[model samples]
Target: MASFEVKGGNKLNGTIVPQGAKNEALQIISAVLLTAEEVTVSNIPDILDVNLLIELLEDMGVKVSRPSRDTCIFKADAVDADYLASEAFRNKGGKLRGSVMVAGPMLARFKKAFIPKPGGDKIGRRRLDTHIIGFEKLGAQFDYHDEEGFFQLSSPRLKGTFMLLDEPSVTGTANIVMAATLAEGTTTIYNAACEPYVQQLCKMLNSMGARISGIGSNLLTIEGVTALGGTSHRMLPDMIEVGSFIGMAAMTQSEITIKGAGVEHLGVIPDKFRQLGIQLEIRGDDIYIPAQEKYEITTFLDGSVLTVYDHPWPGFTPDLLSIMLVVATQAVGSVLIHQKMFESRLFFVDKLLDMGAQIILCDPHRATVIGLGRKHKLRGITMSSPDIRAGQALLIAALSAEGTSIIQNIEQIDRGYQYIDERLRQLGAEIRRL
Candidate 1:
């Protein structure tokens, strides 16, 4: 169990490159099961979840070799064994919720797939019902056992049809797209998640002979193909990390540049942050944040309070709401933050309150942050991470505080960000991984 001890009140002033997206890399690696040829993925992050997923791929008979620390070459030509029945596969696969993505490609290519209950942040009831429903809409039959805690999907030939997802669940949408790419007919998915991660997955599938249209829209049209071939693909830069860096720069009053930021992929990130008076400059593919002593929250025209909320794609991403909430704590105005996705996500605001943040927890889904506007500085204290995003929020708060702070349960942070401490340290943050 690694922990981070951060000595705060340091202005991080340097340039840092963000790593590849963890969410997208998981799906891209899982897509290897759809082809028998060798697939090489570059810019892979050396994180715990990625390593575990690679182990799961190898256990299924795929030959995984790492020519470099951050590059992986995978060949699924010999993956003839059943992946779901192995305990080693089940145990490690259950560690991260992204493991559910394997159900689509495995079932599409091999005619059946067995997956146990997936594990991830215990934020709320993240039901697998959406995924199973999507598969069933495509003519696949599911036999789920509650006591055994295993789900089995079998289909002779998947006949694609119109699927209207109940909600825009990210992983559920990706699973269906992967399955539909190799189905027997045209598959139309409405209300599909159009996040950058899903878009990258579609682009990667297209490069391998799958015909998918509406790459950046909610309606996805996938034309089924007989089979797919292997191709090399690079994962997109992490947008969540970019947002995190923006928050870090603002909190520490540092001037930092983030390299390889996919500017086109950030639909509403810059403008959303602008609402908080955070200025950003896009220099080709990089984002530059200048040093600022203080920032103010922009208000509505009627002189009413402004609220930052999360919605589906093109709207603000729910994943970055925590970082934005923490950023709001230091801005020079008052704003209401509504986390509409999960119930327990806003519960971590208590820790920030302990650090002298002026936060009013309206309820489980809302919080009002009253910024001190540089007048008040958060003091350092020991804290524990509750989830991935909240862990990141706490780290940002710790970096801007005055004194030393210890963050325990850092494994939660490791599940998402790769080499977080090292990267922050490079940006002049006094963070040590203990």
Candidate 2:
């Protein structure tokens, strides 16, 4: 039960190197179960979720060792399939949504997988139907226990075929990708999620000798291989953290540079932030955000109001919607933000309203934010974080407020961002975690 006490009104002026992507690390670690050889992953973030996933892997008899601060070696040569049914596995699996991803590789390599209901941010109903339906299409049979809320998937041999996901669920796409990589035949997944995390999974699979085409598109063609060998791969930078840093720099009128921000991978992030009148300058692989006293939200053509919303890949990511909402509070114009993927994501607007931001909660999924635009600095107050994204949003709001602010329930933030308070503190933010 940690909390963050932030003293605001400080202009953060320095450079920040974003940590490895948490979402990507989750999928990549699960991919280790696809092979028996040792898979070395570098640039691993020291976060709660990653540590929990590592524990889950070790419980499955995968030899996990950390040779360096940001490196880990995983060998699944003698992994115990029964560990998936252990109480430790069930408890940890039920605590994190990313735990569902292990189902594919576990079922693919060991012929069966047992997973409890996964838990994550209670923003909306994150259905596992996509994962189950995708696996079922590949010739796997599922037996679900409703009372226990557990799922058992078994398949003697998986024969890949065509799979059209009902929607572009990120984890669903990753699950199917991991499953199809070792199936008996080629698997074609249409309308797959092509986010960077999914892309990283595909890259890791390819490096391990899995043939996967359509790297950056909705249609993924995976040629199932007999077996995959181990390989070393570095995780990508956390794009969500990059976006958060951008918002922090803008809100606090700071000039900060984000290093190792693979600008090429930021498919729609730059333009999406441009909608909020935030301009970024790119220097090779770095992103520089200059100080801004007043920011304004851009309007649409024909004198109409524009709304910022989340969509599938190449569109804005749903993960950053909370940051967008918080940043919008300081902008000069009005913008309606619609979080289509999650219902309760917009509920955090109440806290912002309490800080003197003009926000109207239309419903669970929508919020209309009227920017005070530097006319009024948000007054610091105590708030509780309801989810990961909301926690980061509250951190940014606290950093930009006029007085001291206390944020409880920092575990949600730790689940995603790595060493967030330390990193922000390095950038001259007065944030302390206790």
Please give the CA lDDT of all the candidate structures.
Answer: 0.90, 0.91
Q: Write the per-residue lDDT of candidate 2 for residues 63-129, one digit (tens) a residue.
A: 9989986899999999999888777777878998888889999988999998799798888788889
Q: Output the worst ten-in-a-row residue range by lDDT, candidate 1.
A: 80-89
Note the residue pairs that clash in candidate 1: none
Task: Identify the runs in model 2 with alpha carbons over 4 angstroms from their true place.
Answer: none
Instruction: Give the Å error, residue 326, model 2.
Output: 0.6
lDDT of 1 by residue, 265-337 (tens): 8889888888999988999999999999888999999988889999988999888999999998999999999
Instruction: Give per-model TM-scores.
Output: 0.98, 0.98
Return the clash pairs for model 2, or none: none
